[model samples]
Target: MKPGIFKPLKLKPFRSLFGAQLFSDLGNWLDFIALQVIVAYHWGLDETAIASVIIVLGLPWVIIGPFASVFVDRLPKKAVMIVCLLLRIVFVGGLFYAPNLYILLLFVFLKGTVSALYDPARQSAIRMVVPDSMLPEAVTLSQLSVNTMKIAAPALGGGIIAVLGPKSPFLFEAAGFVVSIIFLLFLPSLTSFEESDNRMAETSTVKTSFWKEFSEGIKHIFHAPLLRISIILSSAAFFIIFLYDGLFIFIAKQIGFNEGNFGLLISAVGAGSVAGSLLLGQWTGWNRKPVHLMSSSAILSGTFIVAVGLGGLGFLNFPPLVWIIGACLLGLLGAGESVPYGYVLQSETPKQMMGRVSAAAMSLQTFSMLIAPAAGALLAKQLGASFVMIGAGLATTLLGSTMLMIIWKKSGSFQPIRGKQLDG
Candidate 1:
């Protein structure tokens, strides 16, 4: 973060929202690890089942979220967020009592649905209290909590699962939600904040049908060149990004690394992610270029992944610790993925359409993910994980570098006039 990053923290509503996100995201990562344990180790399920969990996580957002996000715009952002958090508490608790894989899938799906709505509303809420000039800093700070938790929660969740049992992590997840709710309770009405901004309909209402709102949002993104291009590049980046993501265990094994130590590799990725995010936030050159941040991220991340694959193939004589370092670099690049897209979505979209537009972008990313895991796993099985990583990495680099060139090819078209909010 930059020296003035703390400026956003001066606002009490933003402070409350930040605190809530910190706890909420921490518990999310903890639940992620705990579920892996319960599904793969405790239940002794097959690889298909484990992958199914990943797919289920994205299913709601991809399939139902874009349309459902219409309601997010129609409701009070704070109320929607609070309700979603409360529902998530119940959904996380449901994991403990789930009797079978099918039941477990249902609970995960429900939780994802709530998150789909909660996330966009949260984005809208941040835009509510934080000034546009400070929006980038606020978002970076919010995501810092997520990346920070990514490093700590995996280790902590693993320890809790081993010591207290697989179900113990859920208790912590619930605690996180409770704390978030406590903080959210302090978020004052932002009616004045909305008024000062001069964006119309600062109040939530239902003048149009759900289908109309949904179509308007989709049209808005498709109509705006920068938003359209940035979103497509971000989504496509993730599609390639995930090609080797779920196959890490196999990648580790093929590279002669122990599978049990996979958590360390993940933690390394988290640390790299935190570092990368902070570095970019402070990097004046790429300060608010969403496309550049994302494009450069894809190219660099691919190169690192390719190196890891080569190491796995005995083409490079790197030790396991070095491999972990490589994974960290990849994780650092992962930080670039969301932050840039988020900045664009918040800064470019109308305040009224923030919920729908963010959801649309997220849904596109999720749509790519819905198939990437299965594809990656199958590819790893057939061609060996190292070869799969190499292929995926090459593709990712090409996509990143190509998209950056195409967008910048046009000069004034990509630059935005900052004074007015995008009605689109």
Candidate 2:
């Protein structure tokens, strides 16, 4: 690899890809914060309505995302990435001119659809460039960027919304997309177009049925004891853990903080997540102990979330200082779950098939994200947000422990210690 942009990364191609990924993700963060503010203030949307919009945005990935892997494999991966980026640039740009709620929702849906297609290509591209031994570190470092970006971007969005109008953030988001496109164009070629063309030509003739590839991906995951258990546990845990989306504002309301303080509250969780992600990145040897680490983290995270709900309800709760600790603990759980999962996916799967396998895992997370808002909103409305949050936390803790026990029985190992390598 040439030295400069490629120094920390083992491969030049991966360095370019990483740069593009970072800028694109930054745009996504800005869009999310800006749009939610529009809904809350301009449209006067209540919690349920806001949650409903989020559910709609998430639904397509669960419904249409599986097919992306098969299609991504057929196309030149870099070309596919560029195409998706262009599509997002066009679609998301619509928000700047209109900025109405209906138009905003449409743009949100378009962005989600674009992401569903784009994600598979990005996953496959990593395998194309990076050496296998470096995957864990790469995955960890990538997540560290994501967590760090998460910490700063939302606050920036909040500040922009406060200073300028709502549309200011959209303009910034558009600028980020443009920057990503420029980075992608500057990327040095990996496989020659001719080589990729020849590689496709020499592979076995295309199967007649499209779903055959999708079925194979699903079957491979189910056959792997660790992968299957991990997916199930993570999905269930996320469903419960994400109640914070609904609970954050409610708790803020309960504690008598104004709308601007909402940014600070979110920042607290982001701070904790950033710390956890950095710790995991620096300590790359924990890949084998994923099951044990995930279980313990989930248990602790859920316990803290339950405490937060109790604090809100004033049920034997301490002062606001204690609540901050609870928030940080919840963030730790978030980081632990995410970092290990990324390492497992990058390390365990064959490079060529990573797109499908990753899509399969992500499909579950998409559904979990979809269900979370609805479930959280309904429970918050009917019973009470506090009760719903407590219940969710308890449920997540139990689910993680159960999944760990089952996986341990099958593999004779519960922790994430390394063992066999799949044929790439």
Candidate 3:
């Protein structure tokens, strides 16, 4: 039987880690929502400018995170986490007084860089503390924190911005960092717990270059047509979604809402995500015919996007509450696609190659994040946000339908992937 979710909370080390993780999660939302508000409402920046800020914030994760993850294995996890938290506090502080957008972007980039390290270190730390058997429960508890807080944090952040001014969320985020660091201090010096001991160590082994390691991952994917195609499709979906992902502020405006209600739009998504997670966690049908599941989810997501487009074009005059409901459905559909894709990824890849496969996949998504936002925003500018949103919806629907048919026709083309080539 699976352990109860709170079972891990009984342990001292786990509690500290949980608390720190909680604060950090909240900080991320506060930072994100605050920055969007500052750019869209306060400074009144255009769509392209808003997209630029989003790209700059994400660049470090794309460029630095992949390379930095290799070092997480070498470093003391606790120490790295603490140092990153300190840097985050400083970086968020810079955002507080960043007189203009350029400086704000710089600080956001720096903050994002350390975040790349901190996340992996925190995950490593969890493995050090939690018993292997309760790993599932511990992870569930952690995700509970993430999803629940995700629902709360955006609303809390918007409330802070509404009353305390846009920069105030940065201050709260800094304080959150401080609190996280304090709890993080309680974690034992888990130095080299998962260490490469002398007995098992291969002294003659020369470390391969990052590119070489990455190439190995690429080879694994390409060798497995199912995994490769699935990853490419997943990345394509992400690219399409993110094209208008950062434009929720403008979307809200078009739908007859202000900055205050923007958080409602996002919070509803979080609620939907939580529901979807719970549903997928229980449902067994997702494992079989996952392509159909994802395609259906994508179809619904496109429908929701079209609804938003209609709202933007004044064709579908949804009330504020109805719009929020639509956002929730979109979120639910998103979680639907992601959970099944993860299952496919796990089933397709060998255990030893999991990290590299994930990293390679992340690189694709990051590239999408870097390029799609600017392109979307530029299109939103030239042709107007409404028409772009409509085109985006139509395109997503087309992509999903086309992929589904292709998979149905060529199911035999994707063979069972694992064998000597994968093992070698």
Top TM-score prediction, candidate number: 1
**Clash-forming residue pairs, model 2:** 288-416, 288-417, 289-415, 289-416, 289-417, 290-416
Model 1: residues with Cα > 4 Å off, grouped in runs: 193-208
Q: For each candidate, what is the lDDT?
A: 0.82, 0.72, 0.75
lDDT winner: 1
| lDDT of predicted model 3 | 0.75
Model 2: residue 329 alpha-carbon error in angstroms: 2.6
The full ranking of all candidates by lDDT, starting with the best, is: 1, 3, 2
Please rank every candidate by TM-score, starting with the best. Answer: 1, 2, 3
RMSD of each: 2.7, 3.7, 4.7
Question: With candidate 1 superimposed using the best TM-score fit, by how many Å does residue 82's alpha carbon deviate from the native?
Answer: 0.9
> Which scores greater on TM-score, model 1 or model 3?
1
TM-score of each: 0.93, 0.89, 0.76
Worst 10 residues of 1 by lDDT: 194-203
